[model samples]
Target: MADGCRRRIVLPREPHAELAAVPLVDLLGERLGFSRDTLAEIKLALVEACLNALEYGQGEVEVEVVAHADAPARLEITVTDHGAGFDVSIVPQPDLTAKLHASRKRGWGIELMRHLMDEVEVHSTPGLTRVRLVRKRKEA
Candidate 1:
């Protein structure tokens, strides 16, 4: 690959689900030069993404991380699953300013991923679901 900062990892769908997502955050955070706190946030974002994949998707999960080798490094992480597709637009946006909040044990992943990353994209077609997350490298 010309843009040499790309890595792809395929994780088997297993009982210990966090196994798949943890290493990804470690690798991504390392590659992006993230600090401890920032790395934790990235891990949380991956957790959200992975949980959704494990819960709804079947079979192995695919994760991709793309970054730059040059100045002002930036990275994009994509997690994909072969599962039932859902409409991303249908997910309600959480209002942080509101006093009352909707509290349910479901549908928080998308929102969390969106809040943590600079950009979040969801794509689904029949049997595949892909979430693309972009994060910028902070100046050292």
Candidate 2:
């Protein structure tokens, strides 16, 4: 609806559950004036976060989106889950140069999220994990 408004969605933990990101991204793109390319990036990142929650979380996954009311508006999205969390520092960097067959497919989500979003924050504990993504609205 209005700028600075927030919306939240809670999803079950299941295969392909990340599909919920589609409508959320569409709404954000329309309301916040996100470019096609930016929307694509946001969608991908949101899916990754959701997938992680579906795969590893112990309870329902929560996605929250906030549209800021600032001079240069911004959007903040967060994906949270109650699960057995891991230390983010331990995740090794992905070898982008490696061939698809040679590289492991397990650890690229965090890296991709960081590359796509202007800011990424991850907080984890024994029972909770939260991934936050932020991007600034493009000025016309």
Candidate 3:
């Protein structure tokens, strides 16, 4: 597929908690022709990023999705916020083999986001934080 197939989106800085998120998620899924299950996972991942932005981001938030409908079946999405960003290193990794009862509250978002996506990338400075996520399409 041509690079023209790539898709991207940007949300205004500090979007409303309950508004604007679902539509963005839907648009991303529709653009990629993702399966129902994949769509759900992507939607949740997008929402998680937005929620984190609302909680910690200050100015504006930007999100981008790029789709390549070929061999790898891939989707690339990036979320950016102009707020104080965290050091990605500190988030704890979940021990799946352990019981799920001892869950902690604060850092689960990063953990889940990383697990759900095939690739996770973070770029942050004092006032800007950007996260890139990728999910490969199913093989034909």
Q: Among these predicted structures, which one has the highest lDDT?
A: 2
Error of 2 at 96 (Å): 3.2
Model 2 has an lDDT value of 0.82
Question: Once model 1 is optimally superposed onto the true structure by TM-score, how far is the C-alpha of residue 90 displaced, in angstroms?
Answer: 0.5
TM-score of each: 0.79, 0.88, 0.76
Candidate 3 lDDT, tens digit per residue, 92-114? 67565553555653556777788
Residue runs of model 3 more than 4 Å from their true location after superposition = 1-8, 12-25, 94-104
User: What lDDT tens digits, residue by residue, belong to model 2 across residues 1-140?
Assistant: 56337778898545667987567777766677788888888888888888888888887889998877565777788999999998999988888566366745577888999998889999999899999998887798
Q: Model 1 over residues 67-129: C-alpha lDDT tens digits? A: 664556666778889888788888777666451554554556788888888788889877899
Candidate 1: C-alpha lDDT: 0.74
User: For residue 116, what is the lDDT in candidate 3?
Assistant: 83
Ranking by lDDT: 2, 1, 3
Model 2 alpha-carbon miss at residue 60, Å: 0.9
- The window of 10 residues in a row where model 2 has the poorest summed lDDT is 96-105
For residue 59, what is the lDDT in candidate 2? 78
The 10 consecutive residues of candidate 3 with the worst lDDT sum are 12-21
